[model samples]
Target: MLLEGKIVLVTGVLTPSSIAFTCARLAQEQGATVVLTSFGRALSVTQRAARRLPTPPEVLELDVTDPEHLAALPEHLAERYGRVDGVVHAVGFAPAVCLGQEDGLFAAEWADVATAIQVSAFSLPALAKALKPLMRPRSAIVGLDFDASVAWPAYDWMGVAKAALESAARYLARDLGASDIRVNLVAAGPLKTVAARSIPGFSQIQEVWAERAPLGWDVEDPEPAARAVVALLSDWFPATTGEIVHVDGGVHAIGAAIRPPAPEPEPEPEPA
Candidate 1:
Protein backbone atom coordinates (compact mmCIF):
# COMPACT_ATOMS: atom_id res chain seq x y z
CA MET A 1 0.00 0.00 0.00
CA LEU A 2 2.76 2.41 -0.86
CA LEU A 3 0.50 4.84 -2.70
CA GLU A 4 -2.56 4.67 -0.49
CA GLY A 5 -5.07 7.42 -1.31
CA LYS A 6 -2.89 8.78 -4.10
CA ILE A 7 -4.06 9.52 -7.66
CA VAL A 8 -1.44 8.66 -10.27
CA LEU A 9 -1.60 9.43 -13.99
CA VAL A 10 0.17 6.97 -16.30
CA THR A 11 0.69 7.42 -20.04
CA GLY A 12 1.78 5.34 -23.04
CA VAL A 13 0.02 2.20 -22.04
CA LEU A 14 -0.56 0.82 -25.55
CA THR A 15 -0.82 -2.76 -24.38
CA PRO A 16 -0.72 -4.90 -21.29
CA SER A 17 2.90 -5.72 -22.08
CA SER A 18 3.91 -2.11 -21.65
CA ILE A 19 5.83 -1.13 -18.50
CA ALA A 20 3.34 1.68 -18.03
CA PHE A 21 0.55 -0.86 -17.74
CA THR A 22 2.37 -2.65 -14.96
CA CYS A 23 3.08 0.62 -13.20
CA ALA A 24 -0.60 1.55 -13.31
CA ARG A 25 -1.61 -1.87 -12.07
CA LEU A 26 0.80 -1.86 -9.16
CA ALA A 27 -0.25 1.66 -8.28
CA GLN A 28 -3.85 0.56 -7.90
CA GLU A 29 -2.91 -2.58 -6.00
CA GLN A 30 -1.00 -0.38 -3.58
CA GLY A 31 -4.23 1.61 -2.94
CA ALA A 32 -3.86 4.44 -5.43
CA THR A 33 -6.57 5.22 -7.96
CA VAL A 34 -4.81 5.14 -11.34
CA VAL A 35 -5.77 6.76 -14.65
CA LEU A 36 -4.20 5.89 -18.00
CA THR A 37 -3.70 7.94 -21.16
CA SER A 38 -3.64 6.92 -24.79
CA PHE A 39 -4.50 8.56 -28.09
CA GLY A 40 -5.93 7.98 -31.59
CA ARG A 41 -6.21 4.46 -32.89
CA ALA A 42 -4.33 3.10 -29.91
CA LEU A 43 -6.90 4.39 -27.46
CA SER A 44 -8.99 1.29 -27.92
CA VAL A 45 -6.01 -0.90 -27.27
CA THR A 46 -5.25 0.94 -24.07
CA GLN A 47 -8.86 0.71 -23.03
CA ARG A 48 -8.73 -3.02 -23.55
CA ALA A 49 -5.58 -3.25 -21.49
CA ALA A 50 -7.19 -1.16 -18.76
CA ARG A 51 -9.83 -3.84 -18.36
CA ARG A 52 -7.08 -6.28 -17.45
CA LEU A 53 -5.86 -4.24 -14.50
CA PRO A 54 -6.75 -5.29 -10.97
CA THR A 55 -9.15 -2.36 -10.91
CA PRO A 56 -10.15 -1.19 -14.34
CA PRO A 57 -9.53 2.51 -14.10
CA GLU A 58 -10.63 5.24 -16.49
CA VAL A 59 -8.52 5.73 -19.62
CA LEU A 60 -8.15 9.18 -21.12
CA GLU A 61 -7.11 10.33 -24.55
CA LEU A 62 -3.72 12.04 -24.47
CA ASP A 63 -1.40 12.54 -27.36
CA VAL A 64 1.40 14.42 -25.61
CA THR A 65 2.48 16.08 -28.83
CA ASP A 66 -0.94 17.63 -29.20
CA PRO A 67 -1.07 20.97 -27.48
CA GLU A 68 -4.85 20.74 -27.20
CA HIS A 69 -4.54 17.49 -25.31
CA LEU A 70 -1.80 18.84 -23.10
CA ALA A 71 -3.72 21.99 -22.31
CA ALA A 72 -6.87 20.12 -21.42
CA LEU A 73 -5.22 17.52 -19.18
CA PRO A 74 -5.49 19.53 -15.99
CA GLU A 75 -9.18 20.23 -16.48
CA HIS A 76 -9.81 16.58 -17.24
CA LEU A 77 -8.00 15.42 -14.11
CA ALA A 78 -9.70 18.07 -12.03
CA GLU A 79 -13.13 17.01 -13.20
CA ARG A 80 -12.62 13.44 -12.00
CA TYR A 81 -10.19 13.95 -9.14
CA GLY A 82 -9.75 17.25 -7.37
CA ARG A 83 -5.94 16.81 -7.26
CA VAL A 84 -3.21 14.50 -8.44
CA ASP A 85 -0.68 13.00 -6.03
CA GLY A 86 1.65 11.62 -8.72
CA VAL A 87 2.26 11.75 -12.46
CA VAL A 88 4.04 9.08 -14.49
CA HIS A 89 5.45 10.35 -17.77
CA ALA A 90 5.75 7.08 -19.61
CA VAL A 91 5.37 8.58 -23.07
CA GLY A 92 8.14 8.30 -25.72
CA PHE A 93 8.63 7.57 -29.42
CA ALA A 94 10.96 8.02 -32.41
CA PRO A 95 10.62 7.62 -36.15
CA ALA A 96 11.97 4.40 -37.58
CA VAL A 97 14.62 6.34 -39.46
CA CYS A 98 15.73 7.83 -36.19
CA LEU A 99 17.05 4.46 -35.11
CA GLY A 100 18.52 1.19 -36.52
CA GLN A 101 21.24 2.73 -38.64
CA GLU A 102 25.00 3.06 -38.36
CA ASP A 103 24.55 6.75 -39.19
CA GLY A 104 21.52 6.96 -36.92
CA LEU A 105 22.47 10.28 -35.35
CA PHE A 106 22.33 11.84 -38.82
CA ALA A 107 19.80 9.51 -40.36
CA ALA A 108 16.71 11.53 -39.55
CA GLU A 109 15.93 15.03 -40.74
CA TRP A 110 15.22 17.83 -38.29
CA ALA A 111 11.48 17.31 -38.51
CA ASP A 112 11.82 13.66 -37.49
CA VAL A 113 14.36 14.47 -34.82
CA ALA A 114 12.11 17.20 -33.53
CA THR A 115 9.24 14.79 -33.05
CA ALA A 116 11.46 12.38 -31.18
CA ILE A 117 12.82 15.06 -28.89
CA GLN A 118 9.45 16.61 -28.22
CA VAL A 119 7.72 13.41 -27.31
CA SER A 120 10.54 11.72 -25.47
CA ALA A 121 11.93 14.81 -23.74
CA PHE A 122 9.88 18.00 -23.77
CA SER A 123 6.62 16.29 -22.85
CA LEU A 124 7.81 15.92 -19.25
CA PRO A 125 7.67 19.68 -18.69
CA ALA A 126 4.51 20.02 -20.70
CA LEU A 127 2.74 17.44 -18.58
CA ALA A 128 4.13 18.97 -15.42
CA LYS A 129 3.00 22.43 -16.47
CA ALA A 130 -0.49 21.23 -17.26
CA LEU A 131 -0.83 19.33 -14.01
CA LYS A 132 1.03 21.84 -11.88
CA PRO A 133 -2.18 23.47 -10.72
CA LEU A 134 -3.43 20.24 -9.18
CA MET A 135 -0.10 19.20 -7.71
CA ARG A 136 0.52 20.30 -4.15
CA PRO A 137 3.61 20.07 -2.01
CA ARG A 138 4.95 16.51 -1.58
CA SER A 139 3.42 15.52 -4.92
CA ALA A 140 5.94 13.67 -7.13
CA ILE A 141 6.61 13.33 -10.85
CA VAL A 142 8.44 10.32 -12.26
CA GLY A 143 9.42 9.57 -15.83
CA LEU A 144 10.69 6.39 -17.39
CA ASP A 145 14.32 6.64 -18.66
CA PHE A 146 16.72 4.31 -20.45
CA ASP A 147 20.12 5.35 -19.01
CA ALA A 148 20.90 7.83 -21.77
CA SER A 149 24.48 8.39 -20.54
CA VAL A 150 26.02 6.12 -23.20
CA ALA A 151 25.03 5.76 -26.82
CA TRP A 152 23.57 2.41 -27.78
CA PRO A 153 23.95 0.59 -31.11
CA ALA A 154 20.55 1.36 -32.60
CA TYR A 155 19.03 3.74 -30.07
CA ASP A 156 20.36 6.77 -31.97
CA TRP A 157 18.15 9.85 -31.79
CA MET A 158 15.99 8.30 -29.11
CA GLY A 159 19.08 8.02 -26.95
CA VAL A 160 19.80 11.68 -27.54
CA ALA A 161 16.20 12.46 -26.64
CA LYS A 162 16.51 10.54 -23.38
CA ALA A 163 19.66 12.50 -22.50
CA ALA A 164 17.62 15.62 -23.12
CA LEU A 165 14.93 14.14 -20.89
CA GLU A 166 17.41 13.55 -18.08
CA SER A 167 18.55 17.17 -18.30
CA ALA A 168 14.97 18.41 -18.50
CA ALA A 169 14.09 16.48 -15.35
CA ARG A 170 16.84 18.24 -13.42
CA TYR A 171 15.67 21.62 -14.66
CA LEU A 172 12.12 20.68 -13.71
CA ALA A 173 13.21 19.56 -10.27
CA ARG A 174 15.09 22.83 -9.79
CA ASP A 175 12.19 24.98 -10.89
CA LEU A 176 9.47 22.94 -9.21
CA GLY A 177 11.43 22.75 -5.96
CA ALA A 178 9.92 26.07 -4.86
CA SER A 179 6.54 24.36 -4.95
CA ASP A 180 7.97 21.29 -3.24
CA ILE A 181 7.10 19.03 -6.15
CA ARG A 182 9.75 16.32 -6.55
CA VAL A 183 10.77 15.02 -9.98
CA ASN A 184 12.77 11.85 -10.60
CA LEU A 185 13.30 9.05 -13.12
CA VAL A 186 13.59 5.30 -13.14
CA ALA A 187 16.05 4.09 -15.80
CA ALA A 188 14.96 0.54 -16.23
CA GLY A 189 16.89 -2.24 -17.91
CA PRO A 190 15.62 -3.63 -21.20
CA LEU A 191 12.23 -5.26 -20.93
CA LYS A 192 10.11 -7.15 -23.42
CA THR A 193 7.62 -4.37 -23.87
CA VAL A 194 6.01 -3.32 -27.16
CA ALA A 195 8.21 -0.26 -27.31
CA ALA A 196 11.42 -2.22 -26.69
CA ARG A 197 10.56 -4.82 -29.33
CA SER A 198 10.03 -2.11 -31.91
CA ILE A 199 13.67 -1.04 -31.66
CA PRO A 200 15.70 -3.00 -34.21
CA GLY A 201 18.77 -3.91 -32.21
CA PHE A 202 17.37 -3.59 -28.70
CA SER A 203 17.50 -7.34 -28.30
CA GLN A 204 21.28 -7.23 -28.38
CA ILE A 205 21.26 -4.81 -25.47
CA GLN A 206 18.91 -7.16 -23.64
CA GLU A 207 21.18 -10.12 -24.27
CA VAL A 208 24.21 -8.31 -22.92
CA TRP A 209 22.30 -6.93 -19.94
CA ALA A 210 21.05 -10.37 -18.93
CA GLU A 211 24.63 -11.62 -18.98
CA ARG A 212 26.14 -8.76 -16.96
CA ALA A 213 23.52 -7.76 -14.39
CA PRO A 214 24.88 -8.77 -10.99
CA LEU A 215 21.42 -9.20 -9.48
CA GLY A 216 20.18 -10.97 -12.61
CA TRP A 217 17.82 -9.50 -15.19
CA ASP A 218 14.52 -10.63 -16.64
CA VAL A 219 13.32 -9.05 -19.85
CA GLU A 220 9.86 -10.48 -19.27
CA ASP A 221 9.26 -9.14 -15.77
CA PRO A 222 8.57 -5.42 -15.28
CA GLU A 223 7.43 -5.64 -11.67
CA PRO A 224 10.77 -4.40 -10.32
CA ALA A 225 10.64 -1.21 -12.34
CA ALA A 226 6.91 -0.85 -11.69
CA ARG A 227 7.52 -1.09 -7.96
CA ALA A 228 10.12 1.65 -8.14
CA VAL A 229 7.66 4.00 -9.84
CA VAL A 230 4.96 3.34 -7.21
CA ALA A 231 7.48 3.88 -4.41
CA LEU A 232 8.49 7.27 -5.78
CA LEU A 233 4.82 8.15 -6.17
CA SER A 234 4.21 7.35 -2.51
CA ASP A 235 5.14 9.60 0.41
CA TRP A 236 8.13 7.36 0.97
CA PHE A 237 10.32 9.61 -1.22
CA PRO A 238 9.25 12.93 0.27
CA ALA A 239 12.83 14.17 0.39
CA THR A 240 14.06 12.61 -2.88
CA THR A 241 14.02 14.46 -6.18
CA GLY A 242 15.92 15.10 -9.41
CA GLU A 243 17.41 11.58 -9.25
CA ILE A 244 17.53 8.67 -11.66
CA VAL A 245 16.84 5.39 -9.86
CA HIS A 246 18.34 2.58 -11.97
CA VAL A 247 16.29 -0.62 -11.87
CA ASP A 248 18.46 -2.50 -14.32
CA GLY A 249 19.54 -5.26 -11.99
CA GLY A 250 22.98 -3.71 -11.35
CA VAL A 251 23.88 -3.59 -15.05
CA HIS A 252 24.55 0.12 -14.90
CA ALA A 253 27.08 -0.25 -12.06
CA ILE A 254 29.18 -3.06 -13.48
CA GLY A 255 32.15 -1.97 -15.56
CA ALA A 256 32.59 -5.34 -17.27
CA ALA A 257 30.68 -8.54 -17.87
CA ILE A 258 30.65 -10.93 -14.96
CA ARG A 259 32.31 -13.89 -16.63
CA PRO A 260 31.77 -17.27 -15.07
CA PRO A 261 34.64 -19.01 -13.31
CA ALA A 262 36.82 -20.93 -15.70
CA PRO A 263 35.67 -24.52 -15.64
CA GLU A 264 37.46 -26.40 -12.84
CA PRO A 265 40.68 -27.70 -14.33
CA GLU A 266 39.71 -31.19 -15.43
CA PRO A 267 41.09 -33.58 -12.83
CA GLU A 268 44.20 -34.67 -14.58
CA PRO A 269 43.91 -38.35 -13.76
CA GLU A 270 47.55 -39.31 -13.30
CA PRO A 271 47.52 -42.86 -14.68
CA ALA A 272 50.94 -43.86 -13.44
Candidate 2:
Protein backbone atom coordinates (compact mmCIF):
# COMPACT_ATOMS: atom_id res chain seq x y z
CA MET A 1 0.00 0.00 0.00
CA LEU A 2 2.43 2.62 -1.20
CA LEU A 3 -0.16 5.37 -1.52
CA GLU A 4 -2.19 4.51 1.56
CA GLY A 5 -4.84 7.16 2.32
CA LYS A 6 -3.48 9.38 -0.43
CA ILE A 7 -5.76 11.10 -2.91
CA VAL A 8 -4.70 11.21 -6.55
CA LEU A 9 -6.11 12.82 -9.65
CA VAL A 10 -5.53 11.12 -13.00
CA THR A 11 -6.34 12.51 -16.42
CA GLY A 12 -6.54 11.12 -19.98
CA VAL A 13 -8.17 7.81 -19.22
CA LEU A 14 -10.38 6.92 -22.19
CA THR A 15 -10.32 3.11 -22.13
CA PRO A 16 -9.00 0.13 -20.21
CA SER A 17 -6.08 -0.03 -22.62
CA SER A 18 -4.96 3.46 -21.67
CA ILE A 19 -1.80 3.93 -19.58
CA ALA A 20 -3.75 6.28 -17.33
CA PHE A 21 -6.28 3.56 -16.66
CA THR A 22 -3.54 1.23 -15.50
CA CYS A 23 -2.15 3.97 -13.24
CA ALA A 24 -5.54 4.56 -11.71
CA ARG A 25 -6.12 0.83 -11.20
CA LEU A 26 -2.76 0.41 -9.50
CA ALA A 27 -3.25 3.52 -7.36
CA GLN A 28 -6.45 2.06 -5.95
CA GLU A 29 -4.75 -1.26 -5.32
CA GLN A 30 -2.05 0.63 -3.39
CA GLY A 31 -4.79 2.24 -1.24
CA ALA A 32 -5.13 5.64 -2.88
CA THR A 33 -8.54 7.17 -3.48
CA VAL A 34 -8.25 7.95 -7.17
CA VAL A 35 -10.39 10.19 -9.37
CA LEU A 36 -10.29 10.48 -13.15
CA THR A 37 -10.91 13.29 -15.64
CA SER A 38 -12.56 13.45 -19.06
CA PHE A 39 -14.54 15.81 -21.25
CA GLY A 40 -17.54 15.88 -23.61
CA ARG A 41 -18.42 12.51 -25.13
CA ALA A 42 -15.29 10.89 -23.81
CA LEU A 43 -16.61 11.38 -20.25
CA SER A 44 -18.68 8.30 -20.89
CA VAL A 45 -15.64 6.47 -22.14
CA THR A 46 -13.69 7.35 -18.97
CA GLN A 47 -16.72 6.36 -16.90
CA ARG A 48 -16.72 2.95 -18.54
CA ALA A 49 -13.01 2.62 -17.90
CA ALA A 50 -13.53 3.55 -14.22
CA ARG A 51 -15.90 0.65 -13.79
CA ARG A 52 -13.05 -1.70 -14.68
CA LEU A 53 -10.81 -0.36 -11.93
CA PRO A 54 -10.46 -2.34 -8.67
CA THR A 55 -12.58 0.34 -7.08
CA PRO A 56 -14.58 2.55 -9.40
CA PRO A 57 -13.44 6.17 -8.96
CA GLU A 58 -15.27 9.39 -9.62
CA VAL A 59 -14.85 10.94 -13.06
CA LEU A 60 -14.26 14.71 -13.23
CA GLU A 61 -14.60 17.09 -16.16
CA LEU A 62 -11.26 18.35 -17.46
CA ASP A 63 -10.75 18.97 -21.12
CA VAL A 64 -7.18 20.26 -20.79
CA THR A 65 -7.57 22.56 -23.76
CA ASP A 66 -10.67 24.15 -22.34
CA PRO A 67 -9.94 27.09 -20.06
CA GLU A 68 -13.33 26.76 -18.42
CA HIS A 69 -12.65 23.19 -17.50
CA LEU A 70 -9.16 24.00 -16.27
CA ALA A 71 -10.51 26.79 -14.10
CA ALA A 72 -13.12 24.51 -12.62
CA LEU A 73 -10.79 21.70 -11.55
CA PRO A 74 -9.77 23.08 -8.16
CA GLU A 75 -13.32 23.62 -6.98
CA HIS A 76 -14.34 20.23 -8.29
CA LEU A 77 -11.52 18.47 -6.46
CA ALA A 78 -12.18 20.51 -3.36
CA GLU A 79 -15.78 19.39 -3.26
CA ARG A 80 -15.02 15.73 -3.94
CA TYR A 81 -11.74 15.00 -2.16
CA GLY A 82 -10.95 18.29 -0.34
CA ARG A 83 -7.24 17.65 -1.00
CA VAL A 84 -5.02 16.06 -3.63
CA ASP A 85 -1.76 14.33 -2.77
CA GLY A 86 -0.66 13.73 -6.34
CA VAL A 87 -1.70 14.40 -9.93
CA VAL A 88 -0.94 12.57 -13.19
CA HIS A 89 -1.13 14.77 -16.26
CA ALA A 90 -1.51 12.03 -18.85
CA VAL A 91 -3.17 14.14 -21.55
CA GLY A 92 -1.68 14.62 -25.05
CA PHE A 93 -2.98 15.24 -28.57
CA ALA A 94 -2.16 16.64 -32.02
CA PRO A 95 -4.13 17.12 -35.17
CA ALA A 96 -3.63 14.61 -37.99
CA VAL A 97 -2.00 17.36 -40.06
CA CYS A 98 0.56 17.91 -37.34
CA LEU A 99 1.51 14.24 -37.32
CA GLY A 100 3.02 12.03 -40.05
CA GLN A 101 0.46 12.70 -42.75
CA GLU A 102 1.27 14.04 -46.24
CA ASP A 103 1.66 17.45 -44.65
CA GLY A 104 5.14 17.54 -43.21
CA LEU A 105 6.18 19.50 -40.12
CA PHE A 106 6.86 22.70 -42.06
CA ALA A 107 3.57 22.37 -43.87
CA ALA A 108 1.62 21.99 -40.63
CA GLU A 109 -0.67 24.92 -39.91
CA TRP A 110 -0.07 27.07 -36.84
CA ALA A 111 -3.55 26.32 -35.49
CA ASP A 112 -2.90 22.59 -35.44
CA VAL A 113 0.56 22.99 -33.91
CA ALA A 114 -0.78 25.33 -31.28
CA THR A 115 -3.49 22.88 -30.37
CA ALA A 116 -0.89 20.20 -29.93
CA ILE A 117 1.25 22.39 -27.66
CA GLN A 118 -1.70 23.64 -25.67
CA VAL A 119 -2.95 20.20 -24.84
CA SER A 120 0.35 18.36 -24.55
CA ALA A 121 2.66 20.98 -23.09
CA PHE A 122 0.89 24.02 -21.70
CA SER A 123 -1.70 22.01 -19.78
CA LEU A 124 0.81 20.95 -17.15
CA PRO A 125 1.07 24.41 -15.66
CA ALA A 126 -2.63 24.95 -16.01
CA LEU A 127 -3.32 21.77 -14.06
CA ALA A 128 -0.77 22.61 -11.40
CA LYS A 129 -2.28 26.04 -10.83
CA ALA A 130 -5.80 24.68 -10.65
CA LEU A 131 -4.86 21.98 -8.18
CA LYS A 132 -2.39 24.10 -6.19
CA PRO A 133 -4.86 25.02 -3.52
CA LEU A 134 -5.35 21.38 -2.61
CA MET A 135 -1.70 20.30 -2.47
CA ARG A 136 0.82 20.73 0.36
CA PRO A 137 4.57 20.30 0.67
CA ARG A 138 5.90 17.07 -0.94
CA SER A 139 2.90 16.72 -3.23
CA ALA A 140 4.03 15.31 -6.55
CA ILE A 141 3.03 16.27 -10.08
CA VAL A 142 3.93 13.55 -12.56
CA GLY A 143 3.47 14.01 -16.29
CA LEU A 144 3.45 11.39 -19.02
CA ASP A 145 6.32 11.88 -21.41
CA PHE A 146 7.73 10.39 -24.59
CA ASP A 147 11.45 11.01 -25.17
CA ALA A 148 11.41 14.18 -27.22
CA SER A 149 15.18 14.69 -27.43
CA VAL A 150 15.27 13.41 -31.01
CA ALA A 151 12.78 13.41 -33.80
CA TRP A 152 10.97 10.22 -34.76
CA PRO A 153 9.51 9.20 -38.11
CA ALA A 154 5.86 10.10 -37.61
CA TYR A 155 5.74 11.94 -34.28
CA ASP A 156 6.32 15.38 -35.85
CA TRP A 157 4.72 18.28 -33.95
CA MET A 158 3.58 16.01 -31.15
CA GLY A 159 7.25 15.29 -30.58
CA VAL A 160 7.85 19.03 -30.50
CA ALA A 161 5.09 19.35 -27.92
CA LYS A 162 6.76 16.76 -25.74
CA ALA A 163 9.98 18.73 -25.95
CA ALA A 164 8.08 21.72 -24.68
CA LEU A 165 6.59 19.56 -21.97
CA GLU A 166 10.07 18.52 -20.83
CA SER A 167 11.08 22.15 -20.60
CA ALA A 168 7.88 23.08 -18.81
CA ALA A 169 8.49 20.40 -16.20
CA ARG A 170 11.88 21.89 -15.36
CA TYR A 171 10.50 25.40 -15.14
CA LEU A 172 7.61 24.16 -13.05
CA ALA A 173 9.92 22.31 -10.70
CA ARG A 174 11.87 25.54 -10.22
CA ASP A 175 8.83 27.70 -9.62
CA LEU A 176 7.03 25.21 -7.39
CA GLY A 177 10.12 24.46 -5.34
CA ALA A 178 9.31 27.16 -2.80
CA SER A 179 5.97 25.48 -2.23
CA ASP A 180 7.75 22.14 -1.94
CA ILE A 181 5.65 20.53 -4.64
CA ARG A 182 7.73 18.26 -6.88
CA VAL A 183 7.28 17.94 -10.63
CA ASN A 184 8.66 15.10 -12.70
CA LEU A 185 7.94 12.97 -15.77
CA VAL A 186 7.90 9.32 -16.75
CA ALA A 187 9.14 8.95 -20.33
CA ALA A 188 7.60 5.73 -21.50
CA GLY A 189 8.24 3.90 -24.74
CA PRO A 190 5.57 3.59 -27.36
CA LEU A 191 2.74 1.26 -26.36
CA LYS A 192 -0.38 0.10 -28.15
CA THR A 193 -3.15 2.36 -26.90
CA VAL A 194 -5.99 4.40 -28.31
CA ALA A 195 -3.57 7.30 -28.55
CA ALA A 196 -0.53 5.41 -29.88
CA ARG A 197 -2.60 3.66 -32.57
CA SER A 198 -3.47 7.07 -33.99
CA ILE A 199 0.12 7.63 -35.12
CA PRO A 200 0.51 6.46 -38.73
CA GLY A 201 3.89 4.73 -38.41
CA PHE A 202 3.93 4.05 -34.68
CA SER A 203 4.48 0.34 -35.25
CA GLN A 204 7.80 1.05 -36.94
CA ILE A 205 9.02 2.89 -33.84
CA GLN A 206 7.66 0.07 -31.69
CA GLU A 207 9.64 -2.47 -33.69
CA VAL A 208 12.87 -0.52 -33.37
CA TRP A 209 12.27 -0.04 -29.64
CA ALA A 210 11.64 -3.76 -29.12
CA GLU A 211 14.98 -4.56 -30.77
CA ARG A 212 16.96 -1.76 -29.15
CA ALA A 213 15.55 -1.60 -25.61
CA PRO A 214 18.04 -3.53 -23.47
CA LEU A 215 15.37 -4.96 -21.13
CA GLY A 216 13.03 -5.58 -24.07
CA TRP A 217 9.94 -3.48 -24.74
CA ASP A 218 6.32 -4.53 -24.98
CA VAL A 219 4.01 -2.48 -27.16
CA GLU A 220 0.97 -4.08 -25.49
CA ASP A 221 2.13 -3.87 -21.87
CA PRO A 222 1.71 -0.55 -20.02
CA GLU A 223 2.00 -1.93 -16.50
CA PRO A 224 5.68 -1.08 -16.18
CA ALA A 225 5.09 2.53 -17.16
CA ALA A 226 2.05 2.68 -14.90
CA ARG A 227 4.06 1.44 -11.95
CA ALA A 228 6.68 4.10 -12.58
CA VAL A 229 4.01 6.79 -12.46
CA VAL A 230 2.62 5.44 -9.20
CA ALA A 231 6.08 5.39 -7.63
CA LEU A 232 6.71 8.99 -8.55
CA LEU A 233 3.37 9.91 -7.03
CA SER A 234 4.26 8.24 -3.78
CA ASP A 235 6.50 9.42 -0.91
CA TRP A 236 9.57 7.56 -2.20
CA PHE A 237 10.61 10.49 -4.43
CA PRO A 238 10.66 13.20 -1.75
CA ALA A 239 13.94 14.78 -2.86
CA THR A 240 13.52 14.02 -6.59
CA THR A 241 11.97 16.59 -8.94
CA GLY A 242 12.29 17.86 -12.49
CA GLU A 243 13.58 14.42 -13.48
CA ILE A 244 12.45 11.99 -16.14
CA VAL A 245 12.43 8.34 -15.13
CA HIS A 246 12.56 6.48 -18.44
CA VAL A 247 10.51 3.31 -18.28
CA ASP A 248 11.11 2.49 -21.93
CA GLY A 249 13.03 -0.74 -21.37
CA GLY A 250 16.32 1.23 -21.47
CA VAL A 251 15.81 2.38 -25.06
CA HIS A 252 16.25 6.07 -24.22
CA ALA A 253 19.75 5.57 -22.85
CA ILE A 254 21.04 3.62 -25.85
CA GLY A 255 21.54 4.69 -29.45
CA ALA A 256 18.48 2.64 -30.45
CA ALA A 257 19.89 2.13 -33.98
CA ILE A 258 19.06 -1.28 -35.37
CA ARG A 259 22.03 -2.74 -37.20
CA PRO A 260 21.74 -4.64 -40.46
CA PRO A 261 22.71 -8.30 -40.72
CA ALA A 262 26.13 -8.99 -42.15
CA PRO A 263 26.28 -9.97 -45.83
CA GLU A 264 26.28 -13.71 -46.63
CA PRO A 265 29.63 -15.38 -47.32
CA GLU A 266 30.69 -16.05 -50.97
CA PRO A 267 32.21 -19.52 -50.32
CA GLU A 268 30.38 -20.98 -53.35
CA PRO A 269 32.46 -18.78 -55.67
CA GLU A 270 35.68 -20.23 -54.19
CA PRO A 271 34.44 -23.79 -54.85
CA ALA A 272 33.64 -22.92 -58.47
Task: Find the candidate with the highest lDDT and give its number.
Answer: 1
* lDDT, each prediction: 0.92, 0.91
Q: Runs in model 1 with CA error above 4 Å?
A: 265-272
Q: Write the per-residue lDDT of candidate 1 for residues 1-272, one digit (tens) a residue.
A: 88899989999898888999999989999999999999999999999999999999999899888899988888989988999989999999999999897776877999999999999999999999999999989999999999998978899999999999999999999999999999999999999998988899988898779678999999999999999998998888888999999999999899888967788878888899
In TM-score terms, candidate 2 sits at 0.94
Per-model TM values vs. the true structure: 0.96, 0.94
Question: What TM-score quantifies how close candidate 1 is to the native fold?
Answer: 0.96
lDDT of 2 by residue, 1-272 (tens): 99999999999999999999999999999999999999999999899889989998989888887788888888878887789999999999998988887656986889999999999999999999888889988899999999999988899999999999999999999999899999999999999999998999997888878678878888889999999999999999899999999999888878846555789877665564
Candidate 2 backbone overlaps, count: 0
